[model samples]
Target: MRSAALSCPFALTRLFSLLAHDQQLRAYMPAQVLLNESVERVGELDVPLCGQLPNDWSTWGFVVNGIVTTIFVCLGIVGNLYHVRTLGKHSNSRLTRYLRVLCIWDVTLLTCTFGFYGFVVISTGYKPWYGDITYLYMVFYPLCQVSWTGSMFVVTAISAERYLAIARPFRKLLSEARSVTKICLLLLVAVMLINLPTFFELTQVSCYDEETNREERMIWLSSLRLNKTYMLIYRIIIYPLTVNFIPFITIVFLTIKTISVRRSAISRSQNTQSLSPSLPAKQDSGTTAVLTALIVKFLLCYSMPTILYVFEYSENEELNSRLIDISNFLIVFHSATNWLIFWRWNVNKSSRSLTQSFIFTKEEAARLTYLWANTRPTEVGRDLLYTLIRANRSLALIFANNPPNQTAVKQPRDNATTNGHLCDCRLSESSRSPACEHNIQLLAKVDSHGVIVGIFCDRIIQRLSSKLEQQAIIDEIRALGRIHYSNRVPMRNTDWMLAKQYLIAKLVKDECDIDAEDIRIVNKFASFLIHEVKCGRTCAIAAEASVAYGFYPSSAYTHA
Candidate 1:
């Protein structure tokens, strides 16, 4: 071999690249020839490219991502499914309906992106056949985008609805069901339109390095240049910041005000209505607490990841791979967290009942109207929650500074007890951990249905009374007397609307054979009671106080 190598140094040079022995040369020669022969042969090489790479998830970092996201996704799916079922099983409530649908949208998104996609990726790590573009575009991106965008719209709609309720106060506007349906339809359309560009631009292409002459393995992403600026606006500014963040902020403001108002009302009112043992008080503070927690947590979940993604895409260099993984994980993680946080922060049977009982109800609107009417014309209306929070903070500071007398006066027990027992400041067994027991008890006592009716009636009467009182009541009656009051045709769904005519009709139905004249007198007297007993004190106190208040009357009052 040395003699032959000396004879041809060029051959020896070539031999160094391979083994010297014929048997060894044959083994190396085939592979070398195969590699050099054509790009096609190189591409077809049996050697594993992706397989040779270390398992990413098996490492501590990816494993944590997998576990946490999996747990969150599972919980979210279960929680949202329960909420949807609850909505379907119960009679429709405007607030409940809105929240229910929102939850469902979130769940669907989570299932696709987190549950399905995540499962596939985790199970088949570094596997070649695992990541296909067709599946990503048709199934993953659309589903995720739709859910996310729809959720944003839903949040916005909820805020807008609340704003209308708070601002208008007295208007007998659209039905909750109708309004919610319309909003949902709008959400669908908006999401569809926003994601339209995604469908066109989301095709998967295999990334190839032509110079290397090997099969490209990674997925190639392409986005349309047209109106990218606008799309960014929608995704970054409008969708996240405007649609989600703004509404969330508005709710927070409102929630704080509401808290302050309720506290003020509680302090001022002599007879505070106790929530049904099972229900939250009418002007419950928990609602604000929950809303605030939700907004804060949601912003935290999405904010950093979104910022990272923006930075990642803005530059052309390879980002820290860890950051990429983290950002991706955050997207799915948020979906899971939304469900858990919502339930955790704002859940109790009583709160649910209260939400159903008043949100979009005629009574609620009337109360809101009464609040507005009571509000001095000189002052601008504000979110009740915002005022409530300010009041609470002020009170907290006042109490904190004025340390109670150092005398061993027993701390007033904040917690209620079971077995008719009382303890020092500690919550009773039932009321410990979750503060839902009191609300539950309250819901049980109230005839939520009749309450709804009276609420609607009170609003109508208040409006009529305000108008009638503005002009002399006698004059108004005389005007009615002079008119040829022909029997009016009853409107359809008069059941839903508690109009004056409908109320009289209902009175007749209840008190069979009672003279219409007596019924009229009773109605007038009832109206007086609502004005005097139900709202008179409230109006007086509200007019006097330049602050927000929540007035909860006794729950034991019979529906008149």
Candidate 2:
């Protein structure tokens, strides 16, 4: 029994050694023989995988991927074209300029890379011949990488720009339209130069199966044999780190930073309002929201694929193929979604009501005037003005009645006092009339530059009438004043003085029925008052200058 047990152990050891020897023999066999054998073992080992492909692609699989990719390509092309045109119309803004470049990148990527791949798979069933053409592989392949990497770089740049705009708005950086365009062009050139190695590293090789008497083409990278280190660096380090990982991290970091900064700014603005009422609050733009949404969507769509790529390993070919298809679809989906986001953003911006504008109220108008003093009137300003006039019919009427350089005139009471009180109209040479006395109650409030800022009837009318009548008169006068103020044109001091005189003459004639000679007299008096005001201001300035120079006005006059 002991001798039989020893023999069994020896037999088991011999069997194991034979199995090891067979494995070694198989490993050293010629590649062609191995290929023939692999074809027979295809069912057991799973289908053959293309370079960097997760699964063995079949005709039907290619067809499906092609169909999905073609859909995205068509949509992407159409949407990006529209985006380019629409953004081009408003290319004055730095953000729009960046977006235009992004759209261009998307179009190029779809046409050169994704679209090309889809065409080849749909037409040729993923055959190696698709890439076997010398120029196609040498030039177009490298260009494809360039476009892909360029697109990632552009997304990174957009994130950076948005972060800076939100976190450090005062810094100039890429705020200018021309600067953004230049940067985009520079990035394109840099990406193209970076991907030039693709042309040199790639070459076509033939794989023959002697048993089946068939030949297949394959893309072989010479760099893998010529310089293994470069292959490792290019595939593992440069492609993933510089082209994918770095940009991904940067986009995520910047997007988070932007969100935090925006929130902080909003909170600070709210607090500032309580502390300093005069400080203008920072307004939010839809562009930031659109960018944020785009970044988030990009992350959601690409994060899984990127992770799979980084940690890629052998797996079930079918599952991997499906995953790859989904990943490719997500990447293409980005182009489609970007156009939609931009379109929605533009529509929302253009459709904003005048009430939402900063130039609607007097305070807002003043603020806008101060901020945009050096710039031309913007759409916001025009919309705000339109809304104001539309809301107040009286204001519109004033604009309609007062044409540029033309003024209506009315006669003033002959016996009006220098103080110009509305009560003085009762002392006119005409018979005592209550209507004349009531008409004299119109008061005009002028600013330092003699522009009529306000007008109203005297409070004596309120005392003479019931509360309801008083309210009605007050409302009427308020409307009239607002209309008059809205009609006043923006002009220089001299022009404004003349305009004010003419406006006052018109007011007198409209309020009180008077002859043409009386209207002329009132106009002359208004002109005389304007001259007197100008002389008084000039004298006051001269007196102050004399005092500052240590010479009294009387002493200066004596010297003269």
Candidate 3:
């Protein structure tokens, strides 16, 4: 149950084995001292884990164990608490739920590591008195095992869920809130059962403390430590497998698969875009870089501990002890500061690909552009982009509301899924005029997979004088884009790319000086806005946004 020592349940067995041959704890004691631990010769070594008069928080051991470690634990606790509170337990996003639970478990691990094993016994210069420390440590041992193992499983669950979201998208196993919660809870119970035997690892015995020169109540290694079968199966095999090996393999596998799938999708998207040169071709490299860094960190930090758990140094106990500290420190640092890693990378700078598609795949983004050529009042798909034009209230004024010069041609595509009508949602050269409400146009090809790769949005960047104006326009378009999509299914792909081949022709089209970058920005902003708006927004917010976008003229700029 020595987590700080990479959980060597066999260490106690090793102690007993040495005792049988008349080798004592002090006989083979290393020059180095331990943190929060006590030892004695054959008989005295059976004393409690902690000394009665433990080092004060401000004592000599305080530098490494007192305020600094305490600060780290406190930060970890507060940071995890912040995540839990900020990401509500009932949030819709499955990622949010996973992160929230992860924060909870991380907090537990931090609390236990700091609480029970707070002070370090750096030196053996002083003869410390042994007390009843065995029962308390054992009581919290199960809790540590639960939290430590639980955190790993939750992370694996997250990786699996994300992989499913991209690779399958239709699977609901780890996608739903209730299902995810149940899965997390089930993992907790499994780990608890696995560590259930550790609850009996502590033994109570009356031992004499040389320093105090009196008999003291001590609880150390239990009788079960001598059971060969129990030691081999329970401690050597089950504990390490549950805590490190299994989770490490799972996360690594899922991450590799996810990256492979992502690369395949990107390759397909690039191929699709090659046929249509106008379509925007942008990959979210930022997400890739960030995820790769995180995965590398995980592999490096957990690799040592996983190895040391199954096979400790049989001959060199000192080396084993040193590795234990190193492994435990790595684990502690990784788990506690995860909040910072996630926030620094994910929360602050989100992937621009999200603005293009809900699935955040390039292939999907290419498809979405077709379904959303442009509806009445300038829209992409079913969403209303904005109330761009003002209507006459006094009179029933009617306008042609120009139809985009859409030319649909039947074309056979490379991919079977992308074989359908090729749509061009732009004004013909002859129809180009200044009166058009939207000079901007889009061109796309359609298959059952929505837009696939043919759709190309033509946006104009000339009207906006400053970068702020362009951003405002994009923001406004996103704000007004809050509308329900009919063909959206929770699991299955919708049939709409070819449902209305004529809709592309029916869309409003014009001319613009905008390029591919502008189109990508528009799509990216649209995607970012989709996740933020689940409900309706007030007019005040709308007005504020409009002013920010310079849609409304200031008093000084307004003319009579």
Candidate 4:
């Protein structure tokens, strides 16, 4: 060996360069080319994950899926937990509040079964600790598929509750907590048992390869018939349809019914005059809004994946691949957006206080009200707010619109004062049409000039009085103030208060550019304030000033 080293023609430096350039070829270097042949061959042996853990980019499949599973599980757990805690504190009706607990249970199963088990083996190259016969068969797998199906069943249950509460108003027993709880639990158990086939097919196993350190994929190589059947049921039938389709359709149906019931309820109340503003009205209104927001979001976000899964399972491998990728990505967006939904639409001070007293205060929740109030009318805000308000108003009409017991009517008190009333009369729209009499009528009373100004568009100062017509100007002002304070009045010009001030100043000082468009802006702003503000006196003054001055020419106003 020593003599061969001396006889080598090429220097050690040259050998190193060749080896560096072509490490793979170093092992195969012929005896003729190199004097010494004892160097261990690089290409002769395969490298395992020990070589590099596949680097971050190469194992994107594992890394992405693993990370997604972790994040989704975390968020789902956190959100469901928050709901449970909040419900425990604020829920007066045990039956209605049970849904929160059920939702948490379902999401917990999802995190454990779908999120945890699915990602664990891929991440660690071993069956999850609970994949043994006891956990997998007895607990995890069965619970996962069952809970998943139960989630759909729960949605259907919620729909049924709505249908009963709306379509069959007499069926109060149907919405009772005991009945709902028994039904939910029984249905959940049935769903789980039905899906137990999933557990029967899964098996814990170990394998060896050159790349022993690399993460393993769930290769469906076993020849067992049950395994294949399980795969079919999971990938094609149950998971796709139950997780995606059933819930989506159920939510859509519930939303429509809920809306329709609301409209009907509101119409029935049109004849009533006194605004007692019952507690049932307020609580129902708030809860209904939250529920609708939650349902709509569930419908919109979850539908795509369900539809995509259906498409993926049906065939078209190329299409399936693309759809799967898109579906996976969308799931992340779906999970993350829940945090936003809770923060934005579900922030009532009463609810917050209830949550604080009953459930431990959550930092995320504490900041939620502030975050929501301070949020500008940007993406998702306006749409969410409109949907919530509409939903709550409908709920108000449904429960609050119930007819008062005729038997409870007492004789008129001696001191009762009745205003002049008009008899019901029929008016023909045209000579040919059948006429209908109004059930109740109002006598023509002296009209306030202020009411006239608020009612019609005078195009000038008259428009300013419209704010007086709003039912709850004080509440609106407080809400606006809350928003302003929450945001620290980031900019005076941009702030709602400051903006209103500037508009008012331009009208009062006469040191401002006033145009026809300015008058229109003023009119619109006046109209909005009429609905939005709580100040009748302020509205009256503004209206008087505006009617006196009329309006500035449209050309005088310039776009900011």
Candidate 5:
């Protein structure tokens, strides 16, 4: 139930100690403490955040500076800790290394702050060590400066890396393991050096402690901070640039350029896919949607604080203090909520134990599908569409060999196509490698299967209409996807149930009714076939991204 304002006891005791030494204070006892109309700061300032506010601000300060801040900073500490642990589990790639560094410093920042404010100050009404030594010279102030500097620059570095890789994939700087390690080390050391001056800015000075009733050491601004030239070079120029402006501008520019470059990259990939379907589709692009979303979050959370530092400074003490408090809250909130962003968007990516994640139920599938539908319509949906178009191509060739008016489920008994389904023979042992491509190439009529993709596109358009048939069409797609996926799963009892749940989500996103679902069903069936047919699980990604899955050899899918 303690107020957060008490956390500034170092600043408060210093201020009142100066008053106790004043010539007017020697005139009386306890009465003189109240008789004084105003108390002015005698010497150098201790902390920027500690200062006076109006008498009416007590309740507001307690809620903001004390309780809410403590809670959020505590949350931030936990979030960053978990983030570090999670990222640490992944293999040491260039991207994962950068992410790990970002998480480590974020933990350092949040933990130090929480220790200082959330625990020490609120619990004991003072700093952790006697004479205010720890608060003044040790933990929170110094760590926060270096950690913050590290976070800002790390983000900028990551942005630059992503943009560079996309804009110039051949660049060797961030591509190699050793180079990434070197960059991470240089970034850490450079940030520490940038904030090195903060340690010398404050020093301990002797002052009378009213509560202890004796002389005690308290924090005060050091002579170095008072130097005019150092202030200009340090706070006015270097601090603003290193802390906010430089990183902010660089990230913004890089993010915009990245978006532009990525659009062109996708276009280039499409052209490449058409010209040479032999190539693996959509190779690693050196960036992820998760990082993009994180960058967006950083922009949203840090703008007000960074803006206030540069263009919006106010001379009024109370107003300025309030603004700083709000900015601090914004920062802590940013650190806390990023975990939600990470786990929400990226839960599927963890390569942890399959037993933990593979228990996919109907509800879980629905949720996963819904997320895919909403967040990645173009990326995920297009991936599904490509495979189906490829499947339709293969399916058309098989049916061409059959007599007219023959159903897909019925055995034609004329060619190798009808052992089970379009992909059944392929998923079995016979056509596993070299992919029957030598024979299929002679029968492939690209024009005959071309219209199938357009028919799928029409179903996506029907999503906007109110026709009752659309639902029925959607239901059929779900039913087919279930059967299609189950067809490759060796007839497990749970396969049908698992497939049905995800179908509900895919159906809801329909613009066209049947073809979209059919496309997704075929893609799912094809990808599943890859897993069951001994190509391994990694090939599922390639099967989803590329068409002509049957054209590639088993070795290609395994590498994919």
Candidate 6:
């Protein structure tokens, strides 16, 4: 029964061949001899369909694909690893957590698609499972589809999350980490189920060729009626709609909504500021810029691939093949470039003390002022400020207790290391004021707090002294001035001044009992030092004043 079932197709193919040969013979005969023939007989010839290779296998094509895949695999691995590590450290925000998961998905998808395909291309000169019903087709194809679909779904989820964050911050939808995790898990399962048909839609068949007297094996869709219908629906409608059309629509809509919300926020802020002329308008330009860049890159990378996949069943086989290759390349490129995007836009640089100080110099100061003026005080900012103050105070105490020795000091002449003394100030023979001497010891502790303050002050002075423009300094001062006024609870001083006063108080409190007079002295000293620094006094003058009241300055300074 099985043999008969297999032979039926070949028998029909032979009958069709004979009919075609007879029809050709009739074509050479006179038209009058065939005048009595029925119209259907001459209208068309029925042809038997046979399984065949999807394309002519090319060695060059396989080689190029293999090389490209290898490059992508390496880049994807390295980039995703970096992204995971970096983002893991800053996963406090909802967007950051989503991004971390997105990185994971990208790595998985790239490995499943390119890594597996690369191995196949290197081993065989054919693509797309080598047109066989092997493990590649039964397992790998479905796995690749699931990964691809899951990635697209995750991208859409990210865009939606951004929209909610920017557009509807007050809404409680998927705001919790647990909710996000649940949704992601559901999306993964849904995508896997959607792609499950891939495993069964394709199969291997034996084709008997009478002319060649041989049996050829080919990979194709199963001939069962239900399977054929399912394949047609999947190829023509379901896959394209699910993977491309819906995802593209969702992402575009969410991105546009997010932009609109941002613009509205900016406009509202400006309007409010206009009403209160003294208030500064704060625009979240950083967030807007990052989102815009991400949207543009996403469109560029995925649009062509989506279009190609939607029309993949077109009659133009060669055109479709080329498009598939191009789409695959684009997918690889997209996966590989995500790490760059995250690094450029998503990574936080605010945790490093020296770098944060440098970054906050001028424009950041203005931004902070604008933020405070336009928006209500946020606990997050306040907490961060407190954290910094605590860290600095701890550092100051550590150095005061464990001062570096003269022999251990290097670069004593550097503004960060000495108060105009080229030699290690600890080794100075001349008597010095306790204030000046303490400042020198503080400077000697470069590994502790001096480096932080020095780098910040140096960058500030560099930017302020540059010939290009002074607007940056003016903006920073304006922002600092606002901070000084609005911080009613922390004393009416700039954040920097407040930090200095706190440090001075900490140092003085340990030596003597806390008292109003002591507080007054510390405040006075902090004000004088800040004034000197702002007035463009050299590091030496500021250091001298910082330690001047308690002791005497040396008669002569020595160079290290």
Question: Highest TM-score among the candidates is held by which one?
Answer: 3
Model 6 vs. true fold: TM: 0.50
TM-scores of the candidates are 0.47, 0.52, 0.57, 0.44, 0.54, 0.50
Off by over 4 Å in 6: 1-60, 128-134, 172-174, 205-218, 223-226, 232-234, 271-284, 309-317, 350-560
Superposed Cα deviation of residue 18, candidate 2 (Å): 30
**Candidate 3 C-alpha lDDT tens digits along 105-194:** 889877776644443222322222236544445556556666777777787787787678668742332133556688888888887887
* lDDT by residue for model 6 (93-192), tens: 5566667777888888777765446666766645432234234544455566677777788888888877776776434222344567788889988887
Order by TM-score, highest first: 3, 5, 2, 6, 1, 4
- Model 4 collision count: 16
Identify the runs in model 2 with alpha carbons over 4 angstroms from their true place.
1-60, 126-140, 173-175, 207-217, 224-226, 271-285, 347-560
Off by over 4 Å in 3: 1-68, 89-91, 120-129, 133-135, 272-295, 312-318, 346-560
lDDT per model, in order? 0.42, 0.49, 0.47, 0.39, 0.50, 0.49
Clash totals, every prediction: 31, 7, 12, 16, 9, 9
Residues 15-126, candidate 5, lDDT per residue (tens digit)?
1222334343222212212212323333563222121222444455556656786887777677767877776475444566677677777777666656555554455443
- In model 1, the worst 10-residue window by lDDT is 1-10
lDDT of 1: 0.42
lDDT of 4 by residue, 1-560 (tens): 11111111101112222223334223322222221222222345422211112222224334444555566666766776776666545433433444564556546554644433345535563222221222333345445445546655665666666556656643332233445567867876767665655555434333212334332222111233124454455545655455556667767877888878877886775443112332334545665676677666656655655553333133343333334444444544444344455455554343431112212123322332222233222322222222222222221121122332321212223322111011111111232112111212111111122133223222222222344423233344334434433433222211323334333333433424444433433333432443232222223333334446663212111100
Best by lDDT: 5
> What's the true lDDT of residue 423 in model 3?
17
Model 2 residue 352 CA deviation (Å) reads: 11
Candidate 2 vs candidate 5, TM-score winner = 5
**Which is the better candidate, 4 or 5, if ranked by TM-score?**
5
Q: Is candidate 5 or candidate 6 better by lDDT?
A: 5
**Any residue pairs clashing in model 5, and if so which?**
459-511, 459-512, 459-513, 460-511, 460-512, 461-511, 461-512, 462-511, 463-511
What is model 6's C-alpha RMSD? 21.0
Residue 256 shift from truth in candidate 3, angstroms: 1.2
